[model samples]
Target: MAIFLTGVTGYIGSYLAAELLEQHGESLNLLVRAEDSQEAQRRLWRSLQLHFGFPVFHEHLSARIRIFCGDLTSPRFGLNDEKYDLLVSSTDSVLHCAASLNRKSEKSCLNVNLRGTLEVIQLARRAHDAHGLRRFSEVSTVAVAGQRRNEQVTEDSAIDWDRSDYDPYARTKKFGEHLVRELLPDVPRTIFRPSIVLGDSRRPETTQFDMVRAFVFLGGLPVLPFRPDDCVDIVPVDYVADAIVTLHQSPRPKYEIYHLSSGVNSESFRELTAALAEARGKMKPLFWPELEAPFRAIVERLSRRRDNLGYTASRLEVFLPYLVWNTVFDNTRVVAELRRAPAPFSSYCFSLFRYAKENRFRYPYREWPEIATLPSTARDSEYSESARHVSAGEPAK
Candidate 1:
């Protein structure tokens, strides 16, 4: 009877949750990684607080949200029989937004992206068999295109089994897409592949700062190591989340897969740097494509240190390939469906850059308020008991 959503604790996932709760009428079944219901509530608050105050979040918590305390890597999401059965029987749709984005670690990518997705697929199968599922949506990334350069990739042309991937993250995600199609042949499905999702276009505040830190590092450089005209595909989280929520809920979306990206309209390094320079009243950094090899060596060396510079270099090292790729995913399908285009990164990049720098590359998170009380809805009580019993190795009565 509710929409089963994963990754509610993540950045983009949190936006999706807020959009669904505020703009639509579907109750949400969120699978959170926690030992019990209380911890799950706190985690949800930590992420959802970016969108609203404690009062509104708690109201939604009591009215529409059901917390399923579990892990994606666990079999059946680690939910006991009664709880898992309740989950399947009460769910008519699925939105799999959870994935491990650790591009450096094959082990992390394998366990989370591959194994975790399999568990979500298995749940969709059960729900479909019990009563036909409405839809299944998977939030994928544009990196699945794999080792592209100076090319505009379309939705259908993005995947080629023979092409080499940039990292373990891309490799596993490409295969993960194959798993959904091969295993869930009968379920209605939609795949959303977003490219370089950065800050929100509507606001300067953001909870995720990995990519921002990398951008800041690059911006502070006097002499860069890339071509000035190379276009980098970047889309704001607001547009990506909006496209996903709209298409996922549509009864007959025009296409099964959509590219939530800037596509051909993506700004080049020159344009992006110029905007930032004007905002900060500083001259643009010089670009020298010939220095790429030497710059890469320096970055690799710096990434080994155990200081703040090393931290930034490490983040940049992981994303260096993406920056130099000069490839963009075509957004024709999404633009047609949504009847609007993503705001260019140049329009909002300065605000995000300034905010990240001012905050020391960390989001100022507020602690859970002491006055808040546990949700008292009947379903909340039932799930709370189930979570406690699961954690204590007892059966829920």
Candidate 2:
């Protein structure tokens, strides 16, 4: 069966596209947004090369895939009548993985996550009517559980939208899930909610450094507001992509929801910091209460310093909601279906940090020289030592 996939340039989508092509070569239609078909193909090729570490895939890419350049928020994915009809008639499965991850702006999140989702659903409906559509996989986020501190968020957990103020992205995803349920009630649909996707477990590669990678940077801070035992559910991008594809390929029920997370194997803040510190050969950061006046004072003072610590501390404040919460995602459904356990974050945290540091935490940008310069201070002593050791042609610690 042919598959029509979105977000071929995104973090998970890039890896997912490679996997789909490897498993179902020449039967995949990648819906990418670009100036034209050539640009889309180029972008896809570059992404595959950068993320998958294989430039040889370019030779076979054209023959194995059809690239469609258009916007997801537009009607029929911004495709013309003939092209839209052709796409609907040719594909048997729809994998909608494209969405705006803007956490700060509600409008932007709603535009892509909610409205864009609606458009994908409409496309699914057309595909079902025009041709026999087998599966419709919507990639959602476990954050849809939204601000449920210290709660066990199961696959069936109800979104508590009234109790707490969720981040814009989470709220938008929740709305998207509801829309799918409302519109595609009878369609063959599956919602995969993945939590905190990190880098590849076997390789030191990541498409973007967002929330999960932010935590690695946070390790440099002297003090952070987190409980040592606060659970942080993080899964690798490879695992998430593989799980989604496996579930999509397998015949299943009419509608299913799977929490693709590390689940019980998720590490705590202390464990995460320890692993990062070991990787860097530095001291682990101290945990301070969220409202501690002295900690806040130190953060405010450091925020003014022109160093990596100050910058990371300021950025950490922006994602404090994620740090402070202790939510455990239940992934029993996924484990049961996949018949395997996810690789623990501890196994790959070191490789992730090493890659981030070696690549200057900015892969394509390579602006490490500017951010790696640290000011001399008592609090930054460990970082200074690590840097000095590395500069002296010695392994850190």
> Highest TM-score, which number?
1
Tell me the lDDT of model 1 at 348.
91
- Residues 1-397 of candidate 2: C-alpha lDDT, one tens digit per residue: 4688888888898878877767655367778787665456457666676544322343344245666667878877788887777777778888889988877678888889988888888888888887667888899998788777786788876477585545788888988888988888777788999988878887887767765446666666777666788888889888898889988887774338999897777889888888778877888888876545565566667757778777765655446666567787888888877788788888888887777877766766222233223223312101123334333434434
C-alpha root-mean-square deviation, each candidate: 4.5, 12.3
Question: Candidate 2: misplaced stretches above 4 Å?
Answer: 51-55, 253-255, 290-318, 364-397
**Residue pairs with clashing backbones, model 2:** none
Which candidate number maximizes lDDT? 1
Q: lDDT per residue, candidate 1, 1-397, as tens digits?
A: 8999999999999999999999999999999998777778889989999997876776687678898989999999899998999899989999999999999999999998999999999999999999999999999999999998899999999999999999999999998898999999999999999999999998889999999999988888887899999999999999999999999999989888899999999999999999988988999999999999999998899999999999888888999999999999999999999999999988999899999989998889888664444433324214343334333334334
TM-scores of the candidates in the order shown: 0.95, 0.84
Stretch of 10 with least lDDT, candidate 2: 375-384
